[model samples]
Target: MQDMSASLEQSKPADSPRDGHLKRTLENRHIQLISIGGAIGTGLFMGSGKVIALSGTSILLVYAILGFFVFFVMRAMGELLLSDLRFKSFADIVAHYLGPRAGFVLSWSYWLSWSVAVVGDVVVVAGFFQYWYADVPAWIPAFLTLFVLLGLNMLAVRIFGEVEFWFGIIKIVAIVLLIITAAVMIATAYVSPNGVVASLANVVAPGAVLPHGISGFFAGFQIAVFSFAGTELIGTTAAEAKNPHRSLPKAINTIPLRILLFYILALVCIISVVSWAEVPANRSPFVELFLLAGFPAAAGMLNFVVLTSAASSANSGVYSGCRMLFGLAERRNAPAIFARLSALSVPVYSLLFSGVCMLTGLTLLFIIPEVMTVFTLISTISAILVIFTWSMILAAYLAYRKRNPAAHQASTFKLPGGVPMAVTSLVFLGFVLVLLALEPDTRMALCVMPLWFVFLLLAYRRRTA
Candidate 1:
């Protein structure tokens, strides 16, 4: 461990190129919105219907439980990142304390996580575009969106931040409007086209919350967990964030509130307005809330919001994947070309590589007749990989606490509950993994995820050799 630490220390000075470093151009507002963007994903907009269908009003409990643990995971991550400003990414912290091989595997695994997620986002966005123009080929919108996002990302880091900021705003406004509209409808006792009245009683009636029993409640975790996939994305922005000490903690601390407002509260409003039993299992409940409230154009507006939400997620994927590649190259885990920065301080090659890889999703659209099936499979795989990523962050935190007791003691932004909380969070994550197997859709991804780790192990050995 001492030798590994020593090597990591030695590599830092050599890795630092005054001109090549990623620019810390991300302001507090950018980090704040990025955090918001990460918390609200396409899964919430698109997949929550399935969660509601399976779990009924118990979906709230599912998100609450997951959000509680996820907050601690972020705290652990925030504490770790703030512990050492030199830690560019969680992979750096993992390599520093858990050894390089673990770091290498995690770096690549995280990249693949975002890669798979972006592909899924691309597929979803194409489907969204076709909602308005049914005759246009799916691949056209898929590739065009990627082309636009890639160009924006290639220009500069702040440009990417600006794009996400507005995307986050759109999502926030849409959810807020939905919540307010639902609240008004519930108060006014507005009735739907099917004669179902909007009322808070709809959400809290006897046995209504768990209509399908505990097993159905358990099934909700599969998709609800996927909705929180990008919550840890804040950790990846440490290298490029301006004044992370202030912005990161503020961002991390508000996670619970975000969950309460954007997830739990929003969901409650939805279930109240359109009883979970009546909510469409395959479509967005958000759009349903607006449409049922007499907004005829709500479909188009919500469709655009979801389209940008998916685009925002894919944009994040592109940004994170390239940055992870850059970090890996800096550590000599990947080809050095990825380490090279453009004049704008962007990792041009890495960005292009990730974008090109995402384009492969277009082919899946052509080959697969059922887009939702492809989305379900890809999203489940991404969720599995995300579990691996969050687990590593917790593990790295434990290692950091053990290896550097003084650092933990001195941290200005410490994770609440420290070591015990980290362990509990890990257990909760494991439980979620167990839940994934309760359904065949997620079970297939769970069974297949091990192959990724095995391949990573082989690659690690060959790289070391």
Candidate 2:
């Protein structure tokens, strides 16, 4: 809808803070696809199974509700970033508006959150690869993917964007094909060998929309919210984006449509092809659809799509984590080494640090394979941190509006509901925290969250002292 190049030219500030020597090599195409890559990942592809198993057909409404509300979160982030081109990273906006203390805690929380997710993704990359070659050492592929992403990121920001762009294309194409194919089959009253008909009737007749009832609907939030965790990634790219004003709003606007097509429509198709009750917990519903339709080749191709999906997530984490560190050092909240960039304008040390953290995931294959679930627990904890980070942005927006009423009034890129939207989004986030507490499995992360804050408080004091 927006003319990207024209908007980019219109929005570029004459001068802003130097990005620690970082380059704005990311083009419009790169940002668009990177935005897509951020929104689609293993959360939807792999974790959707758990959401389907727990939520039943109600996963549709769950994703839609989550998606619709979070757009305000993105909009607030977009307006704040557009208001100040000198700031880099979403965390910087918090620091600028809310004081350095809030910035210090959230910046670290976000970095740790994405770093934890990358560890999980690297483990997953290995697991996905093992499906093709069970004989190979699992850690080998995980380490390979970790190092490869590290290499790509080290070269330049655009290279990382380019790689992620293609990875996003693979995932997009796969979801589109699945949606179209399933629609045709459902229209024809086509039946699989298992005798499951692809029909909208499959959605309701089983047990109404909420098959498992209210508790089941609540159960889906734990995993489904995690599925939405990566959607805020555009915030991290704000500093490096060629044109923050045009690009940020354009990308933010697509969030609703992405939720509809990728999560809602695809899940709709999956349930229609295979009853929610029939969906297996151990395997991806996407693969199950093709295999049931007697298309092993299609199923196999989907496997690779999931593999690349995991890799793309890790790649994004690497990019964002380095930026977080860069933001921290720029604020003098992190060590000076992290703020330094290389000749290619890349945050070399910060990226290597994150890549090293991700490579540690390999130790799971050797030292403690049995307790590998630890990574998953850490990831849930990371999800909690991510939720806090988003909440911080919303909270900062409320502050920004009150503190700078004239700026808020003058901005053309407005948040639709203004302060009310931000307030409601915070309340909804609080409700999600309540949902996390209700589930025993996720309760641990909720309990552990406070400890992270305690550590952050001490760290902040030490840094400031």
Candidate 3:
């Protein structure tokens, strides 16, 4: 009512050196779509079937719980970024609140997480290619997708924003259609191929919520965390966003409802249209629903949608990954050459370095055909690293509360639940780590995580030397 956004844009601190440095070309719509694109991923499109099979109706509860914590994480992130627009990436804020050592660790770990995530996306992209041209080499689409996304990213930040804007729209349209089609089926009493009625009653059926007991429900965390991995991408865009003070809060605020609508509602439709018992964990339930309803065209459409989903994620990986590398170099944690910017104000060298990683991802697919399967292991590892990143964010927030009490009192954006949410979120992240260790396949990631810290420490010491 009092024109909060206008006030935010004008409410710069006395020492606002962060302003006017990076090109703030991203508008509110760009930031909003970026947030949406981050929240939805190949995990939801492909991995939901696995989670549904594992947790059944309780999967709804799983998403709700994780989504709540994610909101708090973003809230903490938004508060930190708004407090100082100079902070470019999460690493910047980590250094400010934590220390240079923590910054070095978080920065590289985040870059590693996205780099591996791009490999996983490339593998998925190649698999999507087989959906049509099985004869073509997997490396073709994998490298080709990376090339196109890299070209677009290197042009300008706005070009990347435009690509993601359309990508997010594609995802939104597909999910909205699913919810509508499923609702119509339920109203018409259309039955699924499995003889299940198109009704909400199926949610409570197939063993009543905890289909495989609480263990199975907890097992949902493995894939669920992967699904939610990129939700923090918005935080990386603070330095590029035209109105970080206004757009940042709006993007972070809408996460909870988007999770409910996109995840909880979409899954409810999937189970109601077909029994969760029948959904396969290995593939997307979206395609299965269409094929069950006798619509190969729709299945194919959903496949294309997911194909774009993988590309969208890869696009984000390059964007966020390059930004992290740039941040690290600027802080002298890495070689200073990566800190140089091109005429477009883009970090060209860092972007190309990440492109090399994407290229290797494609090469791995050809060299070791089994590498595609191992992509799941890589995805698990990415999830663990991202969890560590998010935990640091929450920990940074807690530190901010303690160290800057006056700033917190006078801040325009305030994270609710304060110390409680920070403590609970940290504990929940630890529980997810333990859950990862309990599972045989995912345990490797938790094991490899310590080695990553060791590498970062060694790299940090070498850089300082």
Candidate 4:
């Protein structure tokens, strides 16, 4: 491990084009926490209610199943990053093992997904402000916050890391406190304002783990998969980390712990506090669960935490998007200007570009009073695109394994089940795409994806031309 770390540190040239723009104050611990922070967004705080409404108590099963695939997907990514330290990010891997065309698609597809996701998060931030001031327009907070986030990104990557560190800390503390509260309630058989006691039966009653039937059960997986979309941001940070070899694995290894704490334990606690029947779809189920537990203050507190989560996510999008632009420019994949860095060691062009994309939140305000509807579609599409990116990671892993089976054997963080596990994860992602196509609301994302690919192809062709 020490040798690997040293190798990673020395592998890239001091003035290498790939390393030219990335800020290097990000350390191992920051990378680890940011990975968790990036993955655990405000969605769990706000959107889990929809899954409960669709599948009832059986939502837990969906989380477990989807999380299963997501973990191995991360493992595949870890393997690929370790395969060659010169692979600055996923785009590099896609271009190398696959073809430049595949790399181009993966790069822009992820860029679009995260870019749109930033817009969705901006809308959520707008709503977060309205909780305190009813008359304030959502777009005001959304666009204003985007400006603030852009400034932070431009200041330095370490500033972004510091921000995400605190952001992750808040959500982690909230989940810990929530779990403790739920445990106490379960012990006392605490009854809610809605007249339900905290107990195990809540997760098994009525729906009995498949209440939505097999279809609803699968739909819940779609929701769970979306929740896990940004979990792999650690991989992207590898190039910027002071110790990518150690930090990257340490960050990726937290998958099981995060899934257990955030997804499994949190879901169990929510359902245990309030029956699945009481979980609301239109409103945040997290807020409803706390309110049912008779803590009006809890609703406001969770609201604050989720608001931070959204900010953290949009903040992360801005940072990664900038780094991606830097990578693209180094390879001449994006415009030359985007590859430039500031004296502060920040990717200013990427930050400004991402901020501009996020400013589209104003359009949402103009078109829809209830932006959540559109936000959900866009986020789900983001999740679907993430699946494609994860699939590419697995494909890259397969290629790496075939080329250097010994490297796979020698790695410290090998996927436990090897190729079969990677294959299973890929198949599950494909199934998720199928699920996206089947649902009328999500089907729009499926159609949008092909169009997105075509646009990326044209962009790549134009770039090469």
Best candidate according to lDDT = 1
Q: Residue 309 of candidate 3: its Cα lDDT?
A: 91
Q: How many backbone collisions does model 4 have?
A: 0
Residue-level error in angstroms, candidate 3, position 342: 1.4
User: Which candidate achieves the best TM-score against the true structure?
Assistant: 1
Runs in model 4 with CA error above 4 Å? Answer: 1-19
For each candidate in the order shown, give its overall lDDT on alpha carbons: 0.87, 0.80, 0.83, 0.77
Per-residue lDDT over 1-465 for candidate 3, one digit per residue giving the tens place of the 0 to 100 score:
133234233222222222124589999999999999988987788778878888888999989998988899889888888876767777787877787789889998899889988888877777777778878877778878888888988888998899999999999999999899889988987877778778888888759599789988888898888889999999899989998888998999999889999999999998988788888777778878887877889989988998899889888988999989877777767666677778888888788898887677567676667534656687898889889999999989888888778768878988898889889999999888888876777887788789889988998888768
For model 1, the superposed segments whose C-alpha errors exceed 4 Å read 1-19
Poorest 10 consecutive residues of model 2 by lDDT?
1-10
Encode model 2's per-residue lDDT on 302-355: one tens digit a residue. Answer: 888988998998899888998888777766777777777887888788888877
Error of 3 at 279 (Å): 1.1
Relative to the true structure, candidate 4 reaches a TM of 0.93
- Which residue pairs come into collision in candidate 3? none
Query: What tens-digit string does per-residue lDDT give for candidate 1 at 264-313?
Result: 99999988888888898867788778877888698689988989998998
Query: What's the distance in Å from true for residue 374, model 2?
Result: 5.5
TM-score of each: 0.96, 0.92, 0.93, 0.93
Q: After superposition, how far is residue 151 of candidate 4 from its true place, in Å?
A: 1.4
Task: For model 1, give the 10-residue run with minimal summed lDDT.
Answer: 10-19
